[model samples]
Target: MQDKPVLKVVNLRKQYGSGCDHCDDGHEVTWEKNSCPECGTVYACNDVSFELYPGEILGVVGESGSGKSTMMKCLYFDNEVTSGEAYISSYNNGETNVFEESSQQLRHIRNTILGMIYQNPVLGLKMDFSSIGNIAEKMIAAGNRNVEYMENRSKALLKHVHIPISRIKDEPRKFSGGMQQRVQIAKALSNEPPILLLDEVTTGLDLSVQASVLDLIKTIRQELGISMIVVSHDLAVIRMLADRTIVMLDGKIIEQGLTDQILENPQHEYTQQLVYSLI
Candidate 1:
C-alpha cells in the first residue's frame, strides 16, 4: 500500500511459434515439425507478472526449464512478450507499456534505465576489447558522450568492482572467470542505470569468490540505490542478497514473499523443495 513500483509487468506471455509458418522462431516445433508436431506453440513465459521498486532486490528462482531466463529476456526486451504490458520509468507512477514504445524509445530505455549482466560473460563482454574499453563503450552508449567522462566513469566502475587499475587494458579473455564477471558488472554499471538485472551471476565462481562478488554487488546496490532482479538457482545466494523472492516453475510464479518468510515457511510444494535442496 506504499506506492507503485518503478517497473511493472502485467500478465506477460511469450510464445514460440504461433505465427510465421516457416521460420523456427515462429514455431515451437521440433525437427521439421514431425514427431509431436502439434506440440508447437510452446510458451516460454506464461502469464508472468511482477514489480520492482527502487532500491529493492527481488530474487527470481526456478528449476531448469522453468523459463526464468526467458522471462528475463522478455523484460530486457531482447525477446518480445507475446501479450500483456511492461512498464519501466523513473516516475514510480508513470506507466508506458513496453510493446507500445517504438524501437528508439526501447533502446533509450535499455541504455539509460536498465543494465543487464548476462549469465555468460563471453556473451556479455567484448572479447576483443580491453575491459576498460568495453566499459567505456557501454558508458558512451548510455549517453556519456564525452570521452573524458566515459574514461573516468569506466575507471571508477572498474575500481569499484575491485578490478586492478593495471588490468583495465586487459581483454576479457585474458582474465579469469571471476575477473570477467567483475568486468561484466562494471560494464553493466557503466551507464549508471537505476535498474540492474543479474542472471546467474555467481554461476562460475567458487564459494569464496562468490561471497566476494556478492558483497561487491551489495555494496554497489546500496551506494547507487539501484533496484534489481536477481535470477539465480542458488537460494543461499539469493538469501544473502535479495529482500524478497519469487519461485517460478514451468513458466508460472508458484510462490513469492520476503526472503525469511520463503526460506522459513515456503507455502508451495515446489518452493519447499527448493528451500530443502539448499539444506
Candidate 2:
C-alpha cells in the first residue's frame, strides 16, 4: 500500500431537505431509516467517509436507498455534498478540498482526474454517437484535438474493452446491452484517469455477460494499475473485484474490511445476512 491515498473523503454528508433541530448535526432526534420522520429530511448520505489507495479497488455494497450511489455521485461531482471535504493526491498535492473547487475547476477535474461509469448506459454513453466517436468525445473533453491521435487512441481503448473493430463506428444504441456497457467502459477510460468510479456497473447484465465484464474490469485494473471505487448491491460482484469492501446501511458505513475477511467473518447483522445469502 502507498503511504498516501489517491483519494480521501472526510465526513461527507448529503441531505435532501432543510432540517429542523431534530435532524441537524449532533441532534438526538432519530428516525427509522434515512429520513427524519419529524422533519422529512432525508440524509441520503450521512457522515460517510473512506479512502482509495493507489491501484486498489474499494467496493461499496449496499441495498437500494443505502446511499452507495449517492456517495459515488458526490465523489464524481454529479451531486453537491451537504458538507465535507475530499482530497485527491494528484490535485493540489491533496491539500485542496475538491468539494470546494469552482465549477470550471470541477469540469477540469472531471475531464482529467476522475472518470465515472454510471449504472445506466444511457447516463454514461452517447447512444446516438458511434462507439469510437463516444470514446473520442471524452478525449476531446480532456482537450485532445489531433484527429489522427484521437482516432488511434479511441480504437485502442475499444479494442482493450473487447469491442470488435468492425463495430467501432456503430452507435451505442444499436448495440446489445452488454456491448453498450463495454463501449461505456471504453469511454470512461478514454482520458486515462487515475481514479475511476463505477456505479453498479453490472446491475442489468445477463449472468454470462456480467462475468465477462467483471473479468474485463479485473484485467483493466491489473494492466493499467488505475485505482477504482466500485459500488454495487451484489456481494458476489464485490467479492470478485474488490480488494477491500465496505458495507453500507441507512446512509452509514456499518462495516468495512478486507473482502475475504468480510465474507468469512461479517460482524454487523445486515452484513451477515448479505454474506450468508450468497450461499
Candidate 3:
C-alpha cells in the first residue's frame, strides 16, 4: 500500500522495421504485410516519459497515429520497447526497472502487478466464452493455473465489479457493449494489479455511456488506491479523468502538465491547435 509514484517511464522508444519481428530477442511478432520494409522504420514512440502516482489518473491525449497507444503497450509489455525503461514499484515500495526484469519476474509483474484495458472492449475479451467464463479463464491464467483459487477469485471479482450475481452466469452475447466493457474491467481487476493501463476505454460508447464508464473507473481507482494510465483522443474525457495530461504528436511528447493548466493555458503551438480543434 505504498503511496508514492507507482510507475515511472523514462526515455522510452519503440520502432518498427523490416527485420524487427525476426530479431533474435524474445519479442512476440505481430507485424503486418503492408508494414514497410524498404523505407526506414517508423518510430512509434520516442523518448516519451511520465510517472503515475498511487491513486492518480494520468491521461494521454493525441491523434490516432500519435504514440499514445504504443506508449501504453510498452508500459504493459504488450509490445517490445526498442530502448529506455519503465519502473514498477512493489507493494513494499521497492522499485524494479521493467527492462532489467527476468522473463519469469516480468510474467509475474504482468499477471499480479499490472492490468491493461484496451480501446476496444470486444478485442480484449474472449467472445467465444460467456462473461463469467472469460473471467474465470483469465483468473486461472493470471494465478498461474490455480483453478480452484481462480474460481473463487473470479466470483469475487464479478461481485466487486457490480455485476449482478445472477447475471454472472450469462454470456457476453446477452449483454450490451457497456456491460461487456464492465466485464473487461472486472477481468483486469481480478489480479488486483497495482497499476492499470487504459487505452481509450470509452472508444465506441455514446456520451452518456462513456461518462458512466469513466465515472465508474474513477470510483474504482480511488476505492482500490491503484494508479492508472489512460490514453484517449478525447480531450474532454482527459479533462474529466486525468490529474495530469500528456500531449503527443508525431511520436513525441509535445507537452505535459496538470489537466487544468493545459486546458486553461496551453503553451505549445501543437497544444494550441489541439485545444482549438476541440473548441
Report the number of the highest-lDDT candidate.
2
Candidate that scores best on TM-score: 2
Q: What does candidate 1's lDDT look like per residue over 1-279, in tens digits?
A: 236687888888887766446333435545332122554556667788988887899999988778889988888889977888988767334666876788888888878878898888987899999999998887777667798888888898989998999989999999888889999999988877888999999987888888888998899888888999999998988899999998988677889889899999999998999889888
Q: What's the candidate order when arranged by decreasing TM-score?
A: 2, 1, 3
For candidate 1, give the lDDT.
Answer: 0.83
- Per-residue CA lDDT of model 3 for 63-110, tens digit only, reads 888889988888777788888977767733546568767777777787
What total of clashing residue pairs does each candidate reach? 2, 0, 0
User: lDDT at 234 for candidate 1?
Assistant: 89
RMSD (Å) of each candidate, 1 decimal: 4.5, 0.8, 5.8
When summed lDDT is taken over every stretch of 10 residues in candidate 2, the lowest stretch is 23-32
lDDT by residue (58-88, candidate 2, tens digit) is 9999999999999999999999999999999
Off by over 4 Å in 3: 1-4, 18-39, 91-95, 144-149
Model 2 has an lDDT value of 0.93
Instruction: Give the clashing pairs for model 3.
Output: none
Candidate 1 regions with alpha-carbon error over 4 angstroms: 19-38, 91-93
Q: What TM-score would every model get versus the actual structure?
A: 0.90, 0.98, 0.85
